[model samples]
Target: MIDFRYFLVSIAAIFLALAVGVALGAGPLKGELDQQLRGTISAVSKEKDGLRKQIADLQEGDKYRDSFAADIAPDLVKGRLNGQKVVVVALPDADNGVVKGVEQSLTSAGATVTGTVSMTDKWSDPSQRQFLEELATRLVTGDVRMPDNGSAYDRAGVVLARALVTRDAAAAGRKDSATPTIMGAFGEGDLVNSDSDLPQADLAVVVAPPVQAKAKPTPDSDANQAWVSLARSLDSASRGAVVVGDPSAAGDGGVLASLRADKQARGAVSSVDVADLASGQVATVWALAEQATGGVGQYGAVGTTDGALPKRPTAGS
Candidate 1:
């Protein structure tokens, strides 16, 4: 009769506390408790890492913050469009930055420039490959003239392409036999399109490799069929020149030799290896299908070098 209800309540609370204590200490809940602790530790570790990064960033200074447009504006005013346009196209990422750099530099140099800012990533598109291929093809062919672009960068490409074409053309003309026809594969799978605005020349300058072996390999049967088809089509059109750019993967092995042999009766085959090489002799072996007609061209050695192209300056320039 000494307040039984109060004593009962005290007992229930004590039992609940004991149950919790057992769960935490060598009980079923021990694993769950450890997992919670580990999670907390991991969260703290990540926070520490984030803080370290912030400190590093502060130490590095704010060099990434700079104007791109201010740099080109001055050149634009001085009629130095070539260098400016080249710079702009190469650093298309810095569209606004370039515009800003140009504006500032031009204004300081007593010139006014105006243009809409376009900051888009154009290279991400796959069509760029085709565009570049087409441009390269045109450059290799002396017959086609590059269109004149008002922009400086476009003009640069045209100039460079024309120069290469002249050099390559002279080389092709001097070694005159019947002009060899070249067929290249630009598409994927079996649906390769042999018919395009490809050049028809005696020397098919395949722009697939940067540096190839002096000894050209033979083409396969399937490749041979495609080459035959291309040759016949060219023959019917009365085109004297046959040139190939960016050869298909199948244009290897005996197939090339067969093409050469077939042409030997009428003319000679002149091939250029476009495979990029690193640290090896650029060797190309030419083999004729019937008569082991073969020749080789060795190129200088190359290496795995980075920074093949120029880079944009940071905030400090």
Candidate 2:
């Protein structure tokens, strides 16, 4: 007789066949799956196209803004700094294009560009701190003293600042003149180079850009602090001083960011953080003019800027 197990096996095989058929129907055999996938892809493509168009519109708007600013810049800066003498100091990482743009604006504003000084990376290198201290003593030949008690970089900054800056050119006289000594010393040591003939200047403007530190540094040990000290000292020594950088300087760990955070330095010197373009460079010159008149302000698109530029002087107000 046929075993009962044979019947059980036959029943199990029938159930398995039915399960497979249902699973296949739910999967690749499903009629609507392909159409659903196509619909999803089409929706995504439409979204991407819309986003592209939006980006293009924004870029075109930016181009128009830049063009408009360039056209109006000259009229805004006419005779702003007439008969003033100015000097440019470019930090190691400062943008050459921006620096040149700034020079052009100063010229357009009727300010004499005395010269430009290009600083080397060694100016702020921690590894050369001791050497900088010795060089600082050698470079500064005048009566100017460092009140910070010789933190190498700080002292060096004070020396350099006093050399490049001065309160009154005529009253102070030759005894106060440190430019020749400083230039000779720096030239001999290769700390700085005059991009052209150096002349006496009544005001100073420093061109710096946002820069990353080489490595992890203690709170006050970073190279950026050197710039802060230099800006402060230069402001004190000169009739006016202003620092010009880009919008990037508003970011974390930027030189302008640090300078703005310092309460003492903030008011001592003026700043314009968007000096990359013609309009911004005009703002930079105007800020310098304001500073020379014993005023301080911040002007930039971002960071600690007080406004786009100082308010236009009213009719003899």
Instruction: Tell me, by TM-score, which candidate is best.
Output: 2
Q: For residues 1-317, could you state the per-residue lDDT of candidate 2 as single tens digits?
A: 88899999999999999999888779977767768888999999999999999999999998998899889887777778776777789988788988998888888887778778888878788787788889887665547777756477778877876656567755322333466777767666777887322555668899986555564233244567888888887777777888988877655666777778778888788888888877788788788878877889888888546898887742111
List the candidate 2 regions with Cα displacement exceeding 4 Å.
1-30, 148-150, 169-177, 195-197, 212-221, 314-317
RMSD of candidate 1 to the truth, in angstroms, is 19.6
Report the number of the highest-lDDT candidate: 2
Residue-level lDDT of model 1, residues 1-317, one tens digit each, is: 67999999999999999988986777777888889999999999999999999988975653332123224323323321111111011111222332343334323333222222121222122334355345334334444344443222232233222221222322422321211121122222111223222222211122121113455444433333333333322222221212111222214442223344454412433222212211010111111111011222212211211112112221211
Model-by-model lDDT, in order? 0.30, 0.76
TM-score of each: 0.22, 0.83
How does candidate 2 fare on TM-score? 0.83
Scanning candidate 2 in windows of ten residues, the lowest lDDT window is 169-178
